[model samples]
Target: MTAPITMFGPDFPFAYDDFLSHRAGLGAVPAAAHGTEIAIIGAGIAGIVAGHELMKLGLKPVLFESDRIGGRLRSEPFKDGAGAYAELGAMRFPPSSRALFHYFDKVGIETIGFPNPLAPDTPSTVIELGGVKHYARTKDDLPKRFAEVERAWAEALEEGAHYGELTAAIRARDVATIKRLWHHLVESLDEESFSGFIANSKAFRELGFRAREMFGQVGFGTGGWDTDFPNSILEILRVVATGADDEHRLVVGGVEQLPRRLWALVPEVMAHWPSGTSLASLHNHVPKPGVAKIAPGTTKKFAITDRYGTTTEYDAVIVTCQVWLLSARIDCSESLFHHDLWMAMERTHYMQSSKTFVMVDRPFWRDVDPATGEHALSMTLSDRLTRGTYLLDNGEDKPGVICLSYTWSDDALKWLALPLDDRVRLMLHSLRQIYPTLDIAQHIIGAPITVSWESDPNFMGAFKANLPGHYRYQRRLFSHFVQDDLPEPHRGIFLAGDDISWTAGWAEGAVTTALNAVAGIIRHLGGTAHPENPDPIDRWSDLAPVRLVE
Candidate 1:
């Protein structure tokens, strides 16, 4: 009934709204299969969503979660309790994420413009690089030199990548035009790193190293993308062209609310259960054990063994966990997937992220400075160990949250071995250097919370960020959700996650990919996509990812 929810991002102009808007039915779950159980692995957003939707189509979905339900969209409340919390993962979300926004709107989770480092909503930003402190509320407030660097970067996109042409084609959903524009980019930029793109681009070449270095220190849109400098240019271009790195917002409670709510959201239809069927009702109130192994069955249909060595069989299985788990954690049979697909899963590199949060008595940073008379310091970017510092304002009455340090890559690795106290001390020392006169320590009301996703056994890294020359690898993984091409044994098992999405690191990608997996599972089980809202394969040639070679 409503307009289709599509991401106009040139990388993959997937119409998620089309899939959701299917009014009649998702396809044929044979009369015999109606009540048959489908095994859904990893109770993260992708798995929860796929399970939720499949249940509506008269299939019984048994969701198995190894850890928490939310996955990388982690929102940890203060030790005192819930509400004022630190987002160890996925804090800010972009407005352009229509698929993700759809569910948020469905559940009535309110969102407010996030005050990201240099974005328009942030009251002020302090760029501390090379010991010099520069302050601004916007790009206009930034120094002329830095402004020119930003301009040069924008200009380079227009000329070098045909940014305007590609963006327009993507927004128009002109698949032919998108393929024409993107294929060239895939060929030209796949092997080239982000740093390489800057060096080769006409504008950056003209501007020289200083401009490139400046761009690295305080990046365009999101904070320093320098850690991503070695990744493919196509990756950055997609984020920039889609406007995903701009016009951001954060959930009032936490971004994780979207998935967590979906976990408990009652399905409209129930196959074997009563009227109001939720994920919890499908399983007993007790939590399920972690998955230890998955393999094609001799007669059990599909075999799944839990950590406790309990095994179960299902007609189909959907794996929504990080790909690395298949290799390092799960004892899956080599025969389960093609070698190339397995290689892609193993090669899917996930970037490390570190976040430290402390509760302050109030929004103390909003106060005036004694010496210079500026709001003490709102958001900070620095060359120090604390690469980016964000201030979260809960309320004037309630305690505010200070994300003392948020760093990625090697910068994150620095705090890995340190205890919470030592990490907090290092962050405080780094902050004191930027705000020399402020006694920021005095306002602290609670112990700091910290996380290194890289150190976590369950999650190898925060989210996926494809490397240069890895487009081929991603294309294989992205296409795996489409079951028609798979061998018979692989047909019943589906792969779905943000990692398997083109626009990795965003919730919309996870939702879109999850929905694709849902469609795949339907077709695999002899169901058809609704006529009005066809499956992705129905529009594959035009919308499929650009193959670099062969």
Candidate 2:
């Protein structure tokens, strides 16, 4: 694993004393002395990669971020004596994440496959209906309740089977397959509910029994397609199920180690802006009403506000903030920003999820002779009793160091809204459900519940995903930076984010979009760009043969 790069060592960017001294005098920086090639907002993976690529081309790119350098990939010190960090958000990575893996390899960040000891010995997925636990040992073992899943899967394949032979299934005339795929997508993608889709399916009578339970398992939350803009659930499932491997991987040390390495690769030409500073607004030079000034030169300005409310500006700005945050600052009337983009962005739904990290003074689960060594880090589907827990091996030599994360959906919003005491009681209750053998109340060191989706202002949700009709608008919203559409002098402000790329809502998506944005910027700068590898999995016709077992 690569060591962290310490840019500002002894002196933190803004000292508390300095903050107290100049609490109110913060203001925006005025006009630029020279023109900037590119400006990216939100220093997440996409912005970081885009800036890195542009710097390689000898263009001075400026980046802006409202929070820490690593967006969702943040790690906090565990409250227990584990002597390791706990991940607040994203946790797993697949082997097919070539771009992500390549970046890690280039930067010398090592990774190990996500371990599942229960696998082969026991099924990984468990369905908790009421108080009873039904272990899904295999596809065939899915409770009689989920019988409709087979039918839904079959119907989806049948609809698109004809497009398998076509050169471009996307262009095939079979709208039925496309529509079936759209219906199976999560609510965030389409207005129709899973129940509605199952109802409309050929075997509704047979599958309707498990409707509510199945919906909970497969349903997309606020971040899914049902919210602001809906996405095709079928397409997302196809991409996730087909293109990727089943194994999960962990970054050596922590996930933050990955971004820290990427930051080191950035060239000297690209300016490194401090965290918490974001673009407030843009200033343009307009000469006349219908006809604007033709210096052919444009000055990209920003109004960056820091954590302490201190605001500053840069000549050129590279915005890496969330779309919702950026929408507030941009002047849509200039035609430089698309109205459709703004609308879609405004309507985007963020998931209300929470992570409660409990540091135990002792390894309670180990009392039951729990799986030891690298066989830790157990991943389990959530249940009403246990909620859900991802056990992490803090990489400690001692056996007692363990971090338990409770990832809950609607309960999070409710828990966060409740008073402190009520929240604590609820959490303890949830924890007890999982470790019935251990005394959770006595061994607890600290329990910090991070409600990311509800608290973070910049990003309303965790990441972007497609809904039913979202694909129709995705190409337009994601591909907003076509050469002809952008403002003067800067034709390469290609849209790049987890939402913009084909792989939406993952580290891979961020990397893919960054590569695409870099390609666009390189082309505009009269430089060559590298081509991406073709997707290995075929979307339309690669379904596994269905069989009937009696």
Candidate 3:
């Protein structure tokens, strides 16, 4: 049997899963540094994971949040009290996220197959484009033109990126082969956009214009690559190469539970802290107020000021929030980071995302329509304004939720100015075009919930999507965790979160990067990782992302 492909990095192939599962634990700090306080800015999965690990290493992790915790793993609950909720932020997670699953297992969170378009368990799928609607249970049910686009995509990957060999190497954890193949691709394709890659590929060229449009509208794995067309081809390839876009599962209640649970979990085995101690107990079950300012203090410490005008100094700081907030919302000192690092943070392009969800009486979509002998509604992928619609079935007896519209980038921007009622009406209008007989509004139980990440002051955008020629910028950010090559003034602060990872927008990236921050902190405060369970920094020399010449 072929080894399962995981998010083991075509960029940095360190095994974070192994490190987390190891019995030796993530090393310890010196006796003097044991009780050192480390400020973690942001209460998202990244911040929480970093704090949890840091706490285990006999360090005090102070978490600061501007808004609600869990960041993008937002699970907004309905008043019905039946455990139904709208996943306003991250909804699906791929199984390749081994490191993230470690926390899920630790927290006792369960997962079920996500209702992605064309997924096996998804009752059915509706692919509508250019005023044409095609209902399909699988790819074979779609017209031959879609098959051509699918074939074109496969051929394009194999031809342009050596997809087969690279994926094989990734599955086997053959770091040498992965680095060799990926480095060459990055050097050659870093400047190419996803659309440019498809347009220039021989397979796509043969298929012509409409085929390319189809591929963009209803992409492989998840759905729709049109919004991502402007991003670097390397970004798309990383998703495909590492199986980051395949076999996705939804967390059983909501993904937010992962971070929340981690915050409250008390490890049975810990270093300095007692067995019963937890992050919540340490902070009195509440995080500090939002950060107002961050500046360098005496003796290489960081001075953090909260919104309530309280100031405190810490030995080190881990910033897990969106890097854009550094300039947008916070008063940060210029001397804290190098100019090149600032340039990288500024250049990091974030994609806007909007999701509008409504709770229905039950899984009404499963009802059969007499006239057509088909289900009333299905998981939808479309070119219309309501780009993708998903049906979240809780159970036959419980209320079901429908993500009326889930859009990214331009589509999300279109909904940014619209009010909740207007947004719902517009999305329902678009869905009406697809399902004329389905009375969706009649089944809606409660008020709809919606969010546009770009509109929120706390999160400027949903997640990072590297633009063409952004490899250098991303390299600078991802490598900041290993600060050996950095200047004295910039040495202590570490940048983490999915945005700082090569594979952004995935929870695995968030968890792995948080682990990176943990390792960085351990080393910075006079600690070392166990030789048997070497952390990311320990293996940085051999597996660091390839840096391109300017």
- Cα lDDT tens digits for candidate 2, 1-550: 5221111001001111221123231111112311344656666777766655554444545555556666777766655445556666666676656567667776687776543323332223344445565444354655654555545544543443322322122224233444444333322323443334444545534556455345445332111122211334433443433234245577766787666556555333322333322221111111001111111123334333443444444333333445555555433232435566667667654455566665655444433234522211223444442355545544334323232334344545555565544655665665555435545667656655344465666566676655555544554544543344456534434567776654555677676556556545544544332222211111112321111121
Error of 2 at 44 (Å): 1.3
**lDDT tens digits, residues 514-549, model 3?**
999998998898899998888888898899888899
Worst 10 residues of 3 by lDDT: 296-305
> What local lDDT score does residue 524 receive in model 3, on the 0 to 100 scale?
93
TM-score of each: 0.96, 0.67, 0.99
Q: Each candidate: what lDDT?
A: 0.82, 0.46, 0.92
Q: Which scores higher on lDDT, 2 or 3?
A: 3
CA shift of 221, model 2, Å: 17
- Model 3 misplaced stretches (Cα beyond 4 Å): none
Task: List candidate 2 segments past 4 Å from native.
Answer: 1-37, 79-82, 115-127, 134-195, 203-205, 218-231, 241-245, 266-318, 329-335, 362-382, 399-411, 419-424, 431-437, 447-449, 485-492, 528-550
The whole-model C-alpha lDDT of candidate 3 against the native structure comes to 0.92
lDDT of 1: 0.82
Evaluate candidate 2 by giving its C-alpha RMSD to the native, one decimal. Answer: 13.1
In candidate 2, what residue range of length 10 has the lowest lDDT sum? 5-14
In Å, residue 347's CA in model 3 sits off its true spot by 0.6
